[model samples]
Target: MKYECARVLRGHDGPVFAVRFNEKGTYCMSCGSDRTIRLWNPHREGTDGPTSALMIKTYKGLHGYEIRDVAIENDNSKFVSCGRDKAVFQWDVASGKTIRKFEGHVSSVNAVTYNDDCSVLATASYDSTVRLWDVRARNSFVPIQTLDDFTDSVTSVLVTDHEIVASCVDGFVRTYDLRAGLLTEDNLHHPVTSLAMTSDLNCIVASTTKGHIRLFESKSGVELNAY
Candidate 1:
């Protein structure tokens, strides 16, 4: 498949760290060094490009530092974002207001993702940990679980129906099986920067800081290929 730039989003004053489309692909959420989270209609083009008008909403006044990652819920009713402020924020999309703030990580958060049903949120942080928070719990500031096996910063995280996958600067990609209560660690021997699963869920693709992308069999931890 080939892709082309249909529209250029140009609202953020600083580098945008992450941009994610809602499940339906009707909208998108972006966060970055500007310390703001913006909702955009990427499908719309405004002559030169989508202007500030295409920016549906701007969430501000909460994160005191640069926003690193943003995750939109499956239904697009809410979203989650993590940043240098060391806090994870859950926002109501329509109101553009923060609904909850989950704090525990002692350092910058690098990635954030929602579970299959939006019941939970997982965050990777520079503190070398991945945390799982119960999204529907009220008045709760503690994470439901914390995985801290990394020797270096956890750079990325992804949560699926049955497992939580994370990549770290320690040169490993870890998968936690929620149902089996087991952990699988695949040592790539390179500082892993990001991770994604195959659409069939049978394999994982990991990218490293050394500029290599590796594919692995999801269940067996076998390296399939590298590019």
Candidate 2:
């Protein structure tokens, strides 16, 4: 298959840092250093094919700093944001409202993710910790648990049904089993900047700052290949 750039989404005055689509892929939200999150319609009718995106809405004034990452909840009605502001924000997609603000990180929030149930949110920060938040607990900004075992800043985090996988600036990926309280670390030996699990949950991939990507088995954390 061949692909090409369909649009140059312009709006944010600064570099756009994060972009994501809802479950239905009907809408996409993008954020940047300008602190504004813009929504677009990639599938807008009459575009013919890959063309300029249809701008829908712009969300701003909620964050004091650059928005690092945005995550869509499982239900697609809401989304979350985290970034240099060192806080997490839950926003309503339709009304563009800040449903809640979660705070506590002492440094820039680098990445954020929601669990399958949307009941919990896991946040990674430059403070070298991955914090967990209970989303529905009204104004309860306190983190339920702070995983601070990493010696370096956490760059990315992904939560599964039973474990929390975090990639760090220390050139390694760590998996924490929530039920067994067991910790396992796999040494990529190259600063891991981002990570994600395959849809089948059988494999994972880590991307380093040097432009190298490594693959691994999600279960044993064994090195598979690199490219």
Candidate 3:
């Protein structure tokens, strides 16, 4: 695939820690070290003159410290964000009101995701654990499973129908079976930075702090290739 730099949206005064394209792929939400979450219309039309590449919509005041991560729900109606303030807030995308605030992680929450069915939400934190929340239940937040062997903080977490994968600062990618609570495998030689699952669910793409992106088989924990 050939790509070109269309536009550069320059607004955040600090490094952008995370960016998530909405499910519809029209808008993009970004969080950064500047302690702000800004929405941008990446698809906005451009003029012949030099105009701003992206339009900022809502600057929500949900996080008090540097925003680390943000995740949109499967329905695209609401989103969740966490930051260095040791708090997680669920916000309505339309009204920008904080619908819920989950407080548990002693440090910053680094990652968040909604389950396939949109029933359960998962969050990873600098406290070195992942917490699950029942979205339908009233203010229900709890740590369903804790993988506590990492020597450093858990940087990211990915959940599929069959398994949960967590990347830690200690250069380990640990996969856990959702049903048995067993550690399936630990692969990768560098600290994992991000994770993406293939469409068919047969492979996982993991990016590392050492500037390498690796692919692994979903079941056997085999390293397929790296780029």
TM per candidate comes to 0.94, 0.93, 0.90
Candidate 3 local lDDT, 1-227, one digit each (tens): 99877656667887999988877787788889888787877667434334445655656566778898888886778888888898888888888888888877888888888778767777888888888877888655665556666677888888788677878887888787878977865658788887888988888888998899999887787889999
- Model 3 ranges off by over 4 Å: 46-53
* Candidate 2 structure, TM-score to reference: 0.93
For candidate 1, the per-residue lDDT at 78 reads: 83
**Ten-residue stretch with the least lDDT total in model 2:** 43-52
Instruction: Please name the candidate that would achieve the greatest TM-score relative to the true structure.
Output: 1
Model 1 global lDDT (CA atoms, 0 to 1): 0.89
Per-residue lDDT value at 106 in model 1: 99
The candidate that wins on lDDT is 1
Inter-residue clash pairs, candidate 1: none
How close to the true structure is residue 1 of candidate 3, measured as C-alpha lDDT? Answer: 100
User: Rank order by TM-score, top first?
Assistant: 1, 2, 3
Error of 2 at 63 (Å): 1.0
